[model samples]
Target: MKDKLKKLIIIPAYNESECIEKTIENIQKNAKDFDYIIINDCSTDNTREICERNGFHIINLPVNLGIGGAVQTGYIYGIRCGYDMAVQVDGDGQHDAAFLQKMAECLEETGADMVIGSRFIEKQGFQSTGARRIGIRFFTWLIRLMTGKTVTDPTSGLRMVNRKVMAKFAKDYPKDYPEPETAVTVLHCGMKIKEIPVVMKERAGGVSSISMQKSVYYMVKVSMAIIIERMRRRK
Candidate 1:
């Protein structure tokens, strides 16, 4: 019989005190066999205190490291803990953990190095709003234009990776604006990526401060970053 994969769910959270419990509970209910660690990005709110109170596995950053840094920390921790695979699940609870098992199975059964949960493939979930979707589609086009690979939802945060790819991310990952850039980086390294349709809900709690202008600027900056990433030859 084939051995079971040891999986770790890496949840990066900042000021997610209200949503962290629900996120973990979702994972616990949906992905019962996997272990998880919460990378608390030195939240000013009572995020850390709550995690401690609930006995959640958490690593509190001494300072804020942004999304990219927090996620990289999780990959490093997962690798150190000897997990065979690591899945990125956002703490704000947008990513529905119910699809996590399907993604893991896709990775193992199809020999895919990475699998992404895309809301576009089947259009089955709370897809991004109009403005937000413009950015998602822009990155989708940019990644395909540069890499010749179609990643329909390059901005989607729910992703899974095998150990080899996990180690690569642990060594070098984009600091911010990571999702699109890392997608390009993975293809550049000749890794196989697969996408599965999954439903995504709005954040379970908290609020986003990003305005329309900020979203436009975010698109321009990440487009340039993806181009730069595509140019660099992987060592």
Candidate 2:
């Protein structure tokens, strides 16, 4: 199954000119058999230029759609190309590609619809700041309340999905609070999800979209979004 699986690494990049190259290079080194595409989310910097110069497979978005929209584009692209599985890895150099193959194997062996690389599972390597972990814990409790699934890292961008969930996400995915919201969506759809411990690196460059000032807003907004998604789950 591993030998026959066609996998795609969906990297959603925005203004990651400094880290995008390194991200791709890591994938090339670790998951060489798997193909990858950079969803260039209309970065103001020369991200597209760097990708083009390196001759990487890239889909240039006309406008900035944030993480959700950019990731959805990769799902749509993967479905059209007939990939067996796809994983979302942030282009900011925070997510390491070394764990990608492990996630893929976990998906196949466990027959899970989604597999997440979780930093909190082992509590090793660049665990996000304390304030961020508090927010993460809140979402973890919220997700468990809504779907009975305990996700140690609901905010993690490192996730792999099979073709079925890939198609669903391509059609309908949230623009905000996507990770937690989509976890609820998947659980409500009767799909299985698994998590593997992974150590994430600190961002090599570029400011995070979520700032200290925005943390409160992020928590409140995502909590509301998770509740709404739970209510909207398919019956």
Candidate 3:
């Protein structure tokens, strides 16, 4: 018989000690049906220690690799471990673990390569900041222009990917502001991507890694990066 539980929840963490424990606990409570792995990205805080204490499967990077690298690491591990599906959840406590089952079911039922947990699809929670919201919308338009599909939430961290997507992302993952670029990359590779409504909450503790200045920088850099990636792929 085939494995019934073939999904792995991959949490990319960095200095998330304040919320890591709660995040894991919530996932344990809400997504007990799935296995969990936390990729501790060289957190200066006690993120790794807490993960170990809580008996979570962990992969510790020697240095901080940001969200993209940390998540890619999990994807590489997931593919290596032979998991049929992998889900990315933030350790900052914003992502809703309760949506895991819905996203996973969508992934399996629709045979989509990726299913993103979108906060904007149904407009059911505290939305992002004004500037960040504009940036997200711009990126969504860019993705649609390039991929010919309108993605409601281009930067949502809550997402589920199949083994095929894991393999592709493992081989070539983006570095900065990955979510938008990654969606385009997946579409470029002829993979189907879908979005499901998911309500998100404010982070539980500590400040966001991306500040106002960083958000501005991210918007500029990612805009240029996406255009460059498209040009390179066309060549």
Candidate 4:
């Protein structure tokens, strides 16, 4: 790992106490070389206690920042710590650590600023709910039509990025459903992006923050955000 660029895994947890340990264990077993930071987003559960007792490296936020803020904090830390690359993985144990190496390799070999671990690239694994799948397809078509880049899993949380992208994201990142809109920013900045086939499992514990009602709001918000991003000048 030292021979290559130093990599950091950023796992953001809200109330993922039940699965955080297993998620870390998976990373330790499958990708031991990379370092990791768990952003405890002011969780009400024992997520912070588990991290403390286990001596896991973590940033205990003073407030309950949403997923975007937690992940951006990780990128900021990565830049400050001189990490050459950073990967965002959920703390709910849905993301597979085994795919981290492949994403890193894609980033290095293709010189892409970011490589998204996608479930739809090969049409395998949990394909999400019917309503969410419709939103994903709409965003996929929107991104392709706007940037001419086909991103099958724009909503995927598992993604890896080089230092250049880390710096950009650390400075400014969306605080909501950001994966799709952030991809627009990457393209507008003349950065390259790629997606690789990866399998994702269902969450190990705790309910997803996005309820069925919130899913409708998420789709509308992200769709509008991506459109507004397209109209903006390149940064």
Candidate 5:
């Protein structure tokens, strides 16, 4: 069943010139079965040049759309290209390409609409700092309370969605602080969500976009988004 599925890997890259090549090389070496595209989110760096030099397929946005917008662009492409499933992998080389096939297989076996590759499921790999972990746990509890769903890694970017949800996301995905809010949206839409344990590495290169100053803002913004989404009608 997995062999018959049309899978695509969406790498949402923003100023990842240092790590983008390694990320694509890993995918080419490990996950050759899936087609891939890099969504270059109008990086101020030489990210676009690097992709063009390597002759990799990419969708270069004119303006800097946030992570959510970049990922939605990939979803739009996947749907238009007749893909059955789309898996998101970070361009910072944090997510392992080797686990992509496992995620797809888990989706097939469980019949879930989405599968999240989680770090806390087995508590392995780069668990981050205590402050960040505390924030993640807060969202984890909030999701369970609001949606009656337990997501150990609600902030995880490594996710795979079936075509049904992919089409919806392509039309109206969250613009900022999206990952956690999207999880709530999936529950509101009555889509099945599953989390599988997977190890994650620290970013291979470049600083993380979410700085200490922005972390607080990020938490409040995403938390409010998730709660507010509960009152809206599901699409």
Candidate 6:
């Protein structure tokens, strides 16, 4: 039965006990055909226990790996486990489980290497803070300049990647502000990428890991990193 499940949901959780259960339940209800793996990134809360108790497939990280590491771990796991595709969803409950099947279908039907769940494609939610929104727009333009495709929501955490991409990312993935940079990387590698309109909701619990002060740093740091990465690739 597990062999028949082609798509897997890779959720990276960090102190997400409050919402992880509900998120998992929703995914189970809405996307039953897909299996799920929760990468417990050294969460201080009861996230791991909750996942275990709920009979979810979980990988417990001994140390705290940030979002990028945790997600990449899931991708690696999915690739090794012979899954056809892996979709990344936030454990914070921001992502819509209902859209998983649609995204997976698009990935399979279009033969795209990556399918990004974009909030801005249809402009259907409180996307982000003012500064973050501006930052996302700027990064979107930057990614387009590099990739020759306009990605309206470059920072969206919800995305689906095929096994080929999973192999690539497992080998090398961006650590800081990975979402935007990864889209450019995938494009640079000559892989097909697509965006679909997906409605995102507000976090059901816990505060954001990215604070206002850190948001500024995130923008500048990620911009420089992307430029450097691009230049290196050119050489």
Report the C-alpha lDDT of model 5 over 184-223, residue by residue, as the tens digit.
9999889999999999999899888789999999999998
Give the candidates in order of lDDT, highest first. 5, 4, 2, 1, 6, 3
Give candidate 6's error at residue 47 in angstroms.
1.2
Each model's Cα RMSD: 1.5, 1.1, 1.5, 1.4, 1.4, 1.9
Candidate 3 per-residue C-alpha lDDT over 195-223 given as tens digits, one digit per residue, 9 for 90 to 100:
99999998888678788879878888877
lDDT of each: 0.89, 0.91, 0.87, 0.92, 0.92, 0.88
- In model 4, the runs with Cα more than 4 Å from the true position are none
Model 2 residue pairs with clashes:
none
Give the lowest summed-lDDT range of ten residues in model 6: 1-10
Query: Mind giving the per-residue lDDT tens digits that candidate 2 earns over 84-202?
Result: 99999899899988998899889999999999999997799999999888888988999899998898899998999999999999999988558988887899889998999999999
lDDT of each residue in 1-235, candidate 4, tens digit only: 5456899999999999999999999999998779999999999999999999999999999999899999999999999999999999999989999999999889998999999999997878888888888888999999998888988999999999999999999999999788999998898788999999999998999779889889888988988888888887534
Off by over 4 Å in 5: 233-235
Clashing pairs in 5: none
Model 3, residue 121: distance off in Å is: 1.3
Q: Candidate 5 — what's its lDDT?
A: 0.92
